[model samples]
Target: MAISDGETWVLASHNAGKIKELRDILAPRGIALKSAVELDLPEPEETEPTFEGNAALKARAACEATGLTCLADDSGLSVDALDGAPGIYSARWAGEPRDFGRAMQRVHDELGEAADRTARFVSVIALARPDGSISRYRGEVAGTIIWPPRGKGGFGYDPVFCPAGERRTFGEMAPEEKRQLSHRARALAAMIAAEFGS
Candidate 1:
């Protein structure tokens, strides 16, 4: 499970935010990253129910399409009060074009009157070879949802959710700080450790 230095890795995602995050996470390790959009790869359908399933689905598609090692992640914010309403459907909550504002607003509306505001951000990452073999990693952070969005640094629901034991929302943290504790970063670190024996 060793990746050679200077190997090109395709990040199977169209989101600019995710691409930036992945590049920032892997760049320091000497991996060269190319986003799916950059490669003109079609967005794979995420029909799977679980994060791992979805991640594998995308990774497989991208690997097969480009004949390169592909990395994909499926992440979502789950609120205990909503019983994880937007677990797998987080991106689809606002329909096509993906409106995070509408999605976040809907989450707030649905959680109205619920005493519990506990929530968690979960991420599952899969690295797949063109031959179909795969490796996986997962990370999660427990937190509570703030009524009004705070800060403006992170994308998605970062402004409204604060991880447990943290005084500020992810959006309030600097990029370097957020990368240290973010679910995606945690998962990526785990994957790197497993692959490189770090």
Candidate 2:
């Protein structure tokens, strides 16, 4: 996974947002990234029950498809009061068009008047090599849900999520600011530590 040995690797995701963030993170590191959408690879069914499992499924699928080293990300928002719901189904909850606004509202409606609004964002990054070796890393951030939403930056349930001790919502923070506390960033950091090291 030290990527210092490879010229290019597949980012096993059709999500442009995810790809964009990966590109931003990887490009400066001297790694070339190709998205599954860009490669026209099929997205495997995320039937796995956990983030790590799903990430492995996607990474393996893409590696099998293109015979290249592939990396995939599976992440979600888990609401404590909601009993970890919307964790694996984070994207599905947004529906076909990916209307996060509706998803946010649904959380608001479902958790009506609850005192405990604690939540967390979780992420898992899986990398599958062509030789069938795989490595996984995880990251998370604790936060609380807010009402009426706020700002307009990050995607998903970001508008309503405020990281612990932060005055602004994830949606209100700048991309750089958000990245500092982002689950994905933490996951990537772990991946680098395990695979690339300092």
Tell me which residue pairs clash in candidate 1.
none
lDDT of 2 at 65: 92
Instruction: Please list the residue runs of candidate 2 whose C-alpha ends up more than 4 Å from where it truly belongs after superposition.
Output: none
The per-residue C-alpha lDDT of model 2 at residue 168 equals 98
Q: Report the Cα lDDT for candidate 2.
A: 0.90
RMSD of each: 0.9, 1.1
* Model 2 lDDT per residue over 8-57, tens place: 99999888878888888777667799998889888889999999999999
Residue-level lDDT for 134 in candidate 1: 99
Q: Tens digit of lDDT per residue, candidate 1, span 72-129?
A: 9999999998888788888888778888888889988999988899998999999998
